[model samples]
Target: MMFSSKKRQRGTLNREQKKRRLFLFTVILAIAILFGDYHSTIASSVGKETLTMITSPDYPPYEFYETKDGERKIVGFDIDIANYIKKELGFKLKIAQSDFNGLIPALQANRADFVMAGMTPTPQRRENVDFSIIYYEAQDTIVASKSSNLTKPEDLSGKIVGVQLGTIQEQNAKQIAEKVPNIKLKQLNKVPEIVQEIKAGRIDAAIVEDTVALGFVKANPDLQFNVIPSIENASGSAIAFPKGSQLVKPFNDVLQKMKNNGELERLSKKWFSANLTEEPLSTNSPPAASKGLNLDFRRIIPDIPFILKGIPLTLSFTLSSVFLGLFWGTALSFFKISGIKPLGWFANVYTSIFRGTPLLLQLSLVYFATPQLTGYDISAFQAGVFTFTLNSGAYMSETIRGGIQAVDKGQFEAAMSMGVSYPMMMWDIILPQALKNILPALVNETIGLLKDSSLVATIGVVEILRSAQIVGANKYIYFEPLLFAGLIYYVLVMGLSFAASALERKLRRSD
Candidate 1:
């Protein structure tokens, strides 16, 4: 009996030693990966001489996609001005694009040196970022279908008025709503969407800038716009910089010189003189979107290659997020089952925080708030991967934990009986079986990530949806590109489903 007792003690001591070694290995590896990732990011930005300017690029005459000679590039009044300033300031310029609403957050995140999206410096916006002197002023116009007869702000009473979300026109619409009783405002992300709403009769009218309205009116002959007579001289467009940015003074100086020398007027004439902002890749004029879905697939044929380019980026993002999430989730699962109070509590709390919050909110916080909170200047791609990893880890930890627990508990005892170390048994014998049990769940998560990859477009990662939006913005038509994008997503998801099913069959055959 004493001999047996000694043997048991020896086994216990061996197991404890193995646990310690496993823990040490995991901690060291995690540290190494994190350090390497952060270091590489820092290194990439160290010697860069380029300054990034972020903009929405959907509003033509200010900024929009100009497709010519089978190449699409952002060009307009704002693009010219930004280029001029870059030349004068002796800095290479890199233009970045995002949602109109996301422009301020990009600056706040240090993601851009300045913003020139025909943004006006309202008191509310001024509180967040510093602005340059007014560069160009534009009047707001009420845009509606020809039959609506809603030409004035007073004419909008009891009618629905659409405005681009986060624009000065939205604020102006609110002021109009205050005076015009029963007028309701509907907000959309882009001017094209608001104009489409008017054409579709979803909204009676839209408050759009005159220069922007010109493009839509020409594109959709059914629409008409009348300028809203101003109560105050309109606050004109200005360049936005992060608070306390040194570039503001220099940017303003260049703008002052441009104004004095008539450079700004020259650019204005170059873009604003024409209702069509771009040289269309194809001369085909898509039929006006009628009451039914009148899709002109030919309109986006020239842009199909552009949309297809995003596939690689989308795939890479999904795989990277999946791999990172799997690694993190595996660790979190071990922590939860480690049988230590602190670790279990930490794992549970972390999972709860991530899982309970909306993924969109989490993504926005990580992309926009990380730089402010951590000073990391994380790229949209990096921020997307990191946020998705954390969020996916939370969900997957539970999935993994269940998988691990589903493995016959007797197998663990059997391995322990043979004097196999706990870590060795767990890694070599248990995890393989556990993962097999959870194969379907993992595949589902992967498919979900593939679809979710489109979310990166909001922060400017130029994936499939953003590519389609760019095409729409350039063409002044919305549905065809979006429908085509939808088709691409459907095809991708179907392909993934087939691959996963085949993998499942192969694994089942092996078993």
Candidate 2:
């Protein structure tokens, strides 16, 4: 009887405990739900609607690059106006980044709901994408070297002009070039490159929107550039909504309010020094007749003058690292090939660490952290060059090792049988053949260095991308300037590609 009573008590206690746990869990879950709701955005619960926003964070004073500093937070006029629209309509805003040309495709593919990258609403772009009410007015301007004698469209005759790809300025420059007969236009992806090229005298002049031209001039006060006062056609910049978006009316309503309430003017003054909200669609305005100077690209290919000033710095850094990498890679390859246990193991570990990690991270560590650790400070450019070389070396080592191993063992032994010195044999025979096998890859690495040089911008090398950003931020036409930069990069990459192809053909013929 006692045992039965004890067992019954125990069973009751277990049931009570289990019930208590269940009750606690239910309460906690309810609290979590309430907290989530409390923190939810106004449109979080709204179903069947999402506002997808795409932008490139390369420009400043408009839509500059976002950094971890929270200072890089989106505070430009675009964000302000977009938020106002979102508030009025009660739709969630989803933001993304799209390339200058990719914005429309993203909208078409349903990857983005809209684009707000300071896009100028042009007739050609309208064929593919729908734009909302014009939010700002803009004009095209020329950026040129101050020393250049170009004063008018006719002055551009027989000069090299730079412009952004896919922009009204590019089209205008082309039209003017066609009419003028002597001017040549070089279209690029980013504006900074144009600024740099102009400063370096790579191009005689660059055509950009007025705002961006102002930015370039501001950044380079000592760099003389004349801004012709005669204005180009003025165009309206508008938020491009996806085709058939219901959000357009709501956005337009907010934009009208912003314009009416002077909020738009306030933003424009804060960023652009003047209001661009009025007369947003005056694309037929005359070209700038101002006396401002800008970049000139009129000379022969390679812009020999600028190339002479800057390409040496660029090539010097590249060759120094490339040659160093070749030496280190060869040593590592030999170690890996030696069949020696510890040396091979060490070489493998070295290759894996560098190959597995990002070059940017390594650059930061070496450039920023190395000073703290080793008490030696290196220039950002040098660090960038060194980091690239080291990274390339590790990858190249594997290529070299593969090539070395690929050579027939019989050939090596035949030289040995001839009692040839090992060093002489390698120099006369093995290295020559191995180099032939690896020449294609070496050339690829060189081309890669050209692109990677842009990364130097992160550490402040003012290579093409940084120069574009500096200029874009000056007047807030981030898209146009970046487009110019892209053109420079494209031309460089294409030229290198052509050379690589020619080199490959030559090698094949020799073979």
Candidate 3:
């Protein structure tokens, strides 16, 4: 009986040990899966190689976003071509988006392996980046309001014509303007913006690529496009790559293959021949000009949710930038105040550079240059935070220095008399008072950062302004969404101001 009982106890202990071992193994496996290097795994799973392609997504029949089931996806002819080439070359594809004007800069910065935005290779562009063989030929068309009857290039004489900035059509319009007398050119960032300008009577007509203008004209019943036949041998769309990129030859080879196999023809027919008029029309068509300022806030009511979604991103960006900028600004303030000559000189030069230059330029440089300089594919959010932190630090450092200097010398003398170390004295006795003194200035800076955060829209961070722009583009209406976005910004700034005031009042209680 004793031997049997001992056997039972041993068996129970073995089972318990097995259970513990299984639990421990499961946990370790989970940890490994969670912390494993994703980049390599993703690359291996997807393909042997990965390449980034950047494009401006606002152009349709070329590249644009479509929202379905509440998720936005980039689609169109260029995307189809890109996928085909990616499969042929056995490389995984990743896409990044930016404004049309920012695309070439993105290539120059090595932010993308190649660009496929239905771009035309121009002499000026060739000087900066290499290009693949022309895959598709396109022509410019004049888009105008139906009543205006400005169909031909000659009709645009003595009138203002709009063109999308940094596009082949813009160049075509420039050439036409040279020949046509009294023609004024207005450049916009996106085709939709140009279309909006036409409807608003801000411009008489716009020069748009035939395919792109078709999409807009079909959607806007009041608008029509007429092909410009005078400009023969019009620019053809080609892929762009960084200067001396190895991918150029391979890309050209695939493009040639697509042409030879009639694949290019198939894609063109699929995208170009299809009628885009089936897409839903905007509910907010403008009233007749006789009706004064016929505004429709109801048109953008559904899109309010989309615009509101940007608030969290805007807040997160602003707060993260402010916190990081404050930390960096504090460190820089110390460097400036430090008696060490090199540190002071370096800090002064740093402040001068950031303070002197435009924030938009700094944002662009940081977003584009980081990948080329460091090989880190920084996200839009990360690039925005880093740029804002760096730029704000310079301005804040000066503010902090002034605040620190304003502190009475007697406080330092008293602390030294008590044998307090310099570091502790600053940390405990000096910074608190200095920060209190600079609270209002800091509040002002924070407000400025919140508003300036809109600039990040250029690089495709969908903060408030970018969100509004996207909605404006998608709905093909401008004023309602933008004015709503402005209201949101005003409300947010006021809330921040009130909060800062309350905090200041509380801080005063300490006195």
The whole-model C-alpha lDDT of candidate 2 against the native structure comes to: 0.68
lDDT of 1 by residue, 1-511 (tens): 9999999999999999999999999999999999777655543342335789999877776887765443558888899998898777666788988899999988877888889999989989989999999998888888887667788888999999998889899998998898899999999998878877776778899988888877777767567778899845374899998898877777788899999999988888787755445542222344344666567888888878877778889989999999999999999999999999899999999999999998889889988888788888888899889999999999899999999999998999999999999999999999999998998899889989989998998888888888888888888899998988899988998998899889888888998
- In model 3, residue pairs whose N, Cα or C atoms come closer than 3 Å (at least 3 residues apart or on different chains), thus clashing, are none
Show where candidate 1 strays beyond 4 Å. Answer: 1-49, 67-72, 233-235, 276-290
Q: Over the stretch 1-511, how does candidate 2's per-residue lDDT look in tens digits?
A: 9999999999999999999999999999999998666546444433335676776544455675432221224456677677776776567677665346556655665556678877877777878888888888866666665456565677888888988777667777876777788788887766776666776667888877766565556546433333344434445688886677765666677789888999888788877775333332223233334534554433122222222233445556666778888888888988898889899999999999999999878876676665556656566677887898788889889999888888889889999999999889887889878888888888888777777776765554545655555445534333555566677767877887798789778878987
lDDT of 3 by residue, 101-187 (tens): 898989888778889999999888999999999998977888887778798989999999999898888888888988899999999
In order, candidate lDDTs are 0.85, 0.68, 0.85
By TM-score, the best candidate is 1
Question: lDDT at 226 for candidate 3?
Answer: 81
Clashing pairs in 1: none
How does residue 426 of candidate 1 score in lDDT? 91
- Name the lDDT of candidate 1: 0.85
Cα deviation at 422, candidate 3, in Å, is: 1.7
**Each candidate's clash count:** 0, 59, 0
